[model samples]
Target: MDELVLDGNAAAGALAEIYGDDMTTVLAECASCGRVDPIGGLVAFVHAPGIVLRCTACATVMIRIVQTPSRTRIDVRAKRIPPPPETAR
Candidate 1:
């Protein structure tokens, strides 16, 4: 499992091409475990035909991306989490 898994940064190129922005800093909330983390912190499996991003806490599939000759398909199960409130000094 360790050999097959990779950090979410591996998908940064593909994600940037699709979203036209750097997605690594984006925060996502796992639907299954309610764990929030940046997209770069998720577990990534890119050896398959498509890229699969899973939650680090519960191993839940958060995002999947596949590219075809005609178009690119992406399924995102994780929703964005708002940044935490800033504290006053």
Candidate 2:
């Protein structure tokens, strides 16, 4: 059976709760595809035990966030990308 897929925004609440920031705006680089995008651009699978965020370009797993009774576990495999420098206007 096929699982329902969602946009990364679906995990925003959980991510914000754990990060205490709007993580969706964070830039991430996909290890497999070398594509850089905001966390909100990734594909999300939320029906599993935890939230799985994948690269939109290659569908590679980027971040996995799991919440347990004892502790919250986060596995971040994606590289953080720095924003481009702004040019003088």
Leading candidate by TM-score: 1
- Model 2 lDDT-worst window of ten: 80-89
Question: Model 1 clash pairs?
Answer: none
Best by lDDT: 1
Q: Could you tell me every candidate's TM-score relative to the true structure?
A: 0.85, 0.82
Instruction: List, residue by residue over 1-89, the lDDT tens digit for candidate 1.
Output: 67989989998887776776788989999999999989998999999999999999999999888877876667788988332223200
User: What's model 2's lDDT at 20?
Assistant: 59
TM-score of candidate 2 on Cα atoms, chains taken together: 0.82
lDDT of each: 0.82, 0.79
What lDDT is reached at residue 6 by model 1?
Answer: 93
In model 1, what is the error at residue 77, expressed in angstroms?
0.2
